[model samples]
Target chain A: DVKVTQSSRYLVKRTGEKVFLECVQDMDHENMFWYRQDPGLGLRLIYFSYDVKMKEKGDIPEGYSVSREKKERFSLILESASTNQTSMYLCASVGSTDEQYFGPGTRLTVT
Target chain B: EDKVVQSPLSLVVHEGDTVTLNCSYEVTNFRSLLWYKQEKKAPTFLFMLTSSGIEKKSGRLSSILDKKELFSILNITATQTGDSAIYLCAHCNYNQGGKLIFGQGTELSVKP
Candidate 1:
């Protein structure tokens, strides 16, 4: 089984603070993604990395960035946390056309 | 732009009842359609449908995709309280790095 692990299950940050969400996958999948899920909005992609040091912006990338320094780890960075940035963040990994395996998710709350 | 839509937004059924969830999509360079079951945390893989008219099944859950009609249906028989979850449908496009375009999802609640 593929296992995806997120660094934190829940987090709370003050406004204007910097936040980091980490993810690691044991499957060594070539593609990793970060998504924010909201009620009525579904899961919207924030950023994705196809290979080490290669990143692409997804539909909603503003105020968010990602890092893929290694094949097994991906990190999402919040430049300046705000109330609007509070959301359920999910990390996923996939190899080829197979289904994506997702981490347990991190529920971030910005105050 | 690629898009996936699912309906009805939510449903409630009693145990032992059967329920059907619907998903429709409009995408370029379509590759495959996938189903996922999400509880409170992560979404778990359910089925992946690449061909039309063929049904994929696991236990009481089954799904079929119709490429020509650009839609799919997921059916659950003998529903149990454990079957209550958000069912998500995603369309994959290889040209888009196999990026999955997901529907809003159908929330199913089974009462015992």
Candidate 2:
């Protein structure tokens, strides 16, 4: 079974504070993705990395960045947490068969 | 621009009711379509459709794709409270670098 784990299930941060969200996949998939889900907007892509030291911007990459130093781990960084950044963050890794498996998700709240 | 669109952004139904969710795409180099169910946290994979006119079924859930029409539909029968969730639709393209373009999703609420 493919297992994807997130660094935290919930996080609270003050405004202007930096936040790091980590994701680790045990399946050794090469492609990892970060997405932020809102109430009505659904899931909007934040960033994705296809390989170590390589990254691509997604639809909503503003105020967010990602790092992939290792194949199994991907990290999403929020430069400065804002109230609008309070949302559920999801990480996903693509399988060999083109199927994408997701982690449990991190709910971040910026106060 | 490649896009995936889903109808009925929100739906509320009583127990034992049947529901159908729609997804349409105008994606360039479309490879496959996928459906996922999200209750509170992560979205769980439900189905992936590649061919036209082939129906994939699992328990009370089933889905079919139509390549000719560039659309797909997921059907749920005898829905219970457990069936309530946000159903997401996404399309994968050949040149997207493994990124899946997703729709806004349909929020289904099943009342007991």
Candidate 3:
């Protein structure tokens, strides 16, 4: 079985505070992704890393950054979290099969 | 830009009703189409369709892809309350650095 774990299930941060959401996958997949899901907008990609020390911007990468120092771990960084960034953040890893297995998610609330 | 769009943004149905969710895409170098179910948190993988005219089934949930038409449909038959969730459609393109482009998703609400 594939397992993806997030650093926190729920997080609360003040405005302008930096937030770090970590994700670790036991599958050793090459691709890792960060997405934020809103009520009507659905899940929108924030960033993705295909390799260690390499990252790519997704559709909505304006307020988020990602780091992949190792193959099994990926971290999402919110430079300065704001109220608009309050949403459920998800991390996913995809192996050779193209199935992106996702973590439970981190619900971030910026007050 | 590579895009995926799902129709019927929200649907409400009673138990045992059959529902068909539509997904259409216009992407360059399409690799595969994937269906996922999201209840509250993460989107769970449902099906991945690469070839056209082939149906992927899991119990009452099935999906079909049409490469030429650039669309796909996910059908849920004999639905139960457990089937109520947000259904997502995403497309993978070779040129997108293996990233999957996702649609807005269809919100399904099943009532007894």
lDDT of 2 by residue, B4-94 (tens): 8898999999999999999999988988899999988799999989899999999999999999999999999999999999999999878
Best of the candidates, lDDT: 1
Task: Write candidate 1's Cα lDDT for A1-111 as tens digits.
Answer: 899999999999999999999999998799999999998778899999999999999999999999999999999999999999999999999986659999999999999
Better of 1 and 2 by lDDT: 1
User: What is candidate 3's CAPRI-style docking category based on DockQ?
Assistant: medium
Listing candidates in order, what is each one's chain A TM-score? 0.98, 0.98, 0.98
Q: Pick the candidate with the highest TM-score.
A: 1
Per-residue lDDT tens digits for candidate 1, residues B26-50, read 9988899999999998999999999
What alpha-carbon RMSD in Å does predicted model 1 have with respect to the real structure? 0.7
What is the C-alpha lDDT profile of model 2 across A1-111, one tens digit per residue? Answer: 999999999999999999999999999799999999988787888999989999999999999988899999999999999999999999999976667899999999999
CAPRI-wise, candidate 1 is medium
lDDT of each: 0.94, 0.93, 0.92
DockQ of 1: 0.74
What tens digits encode model 3's per-residue C-alpha lDDT throughout B49-70?
Answer: 9999999999999999999889
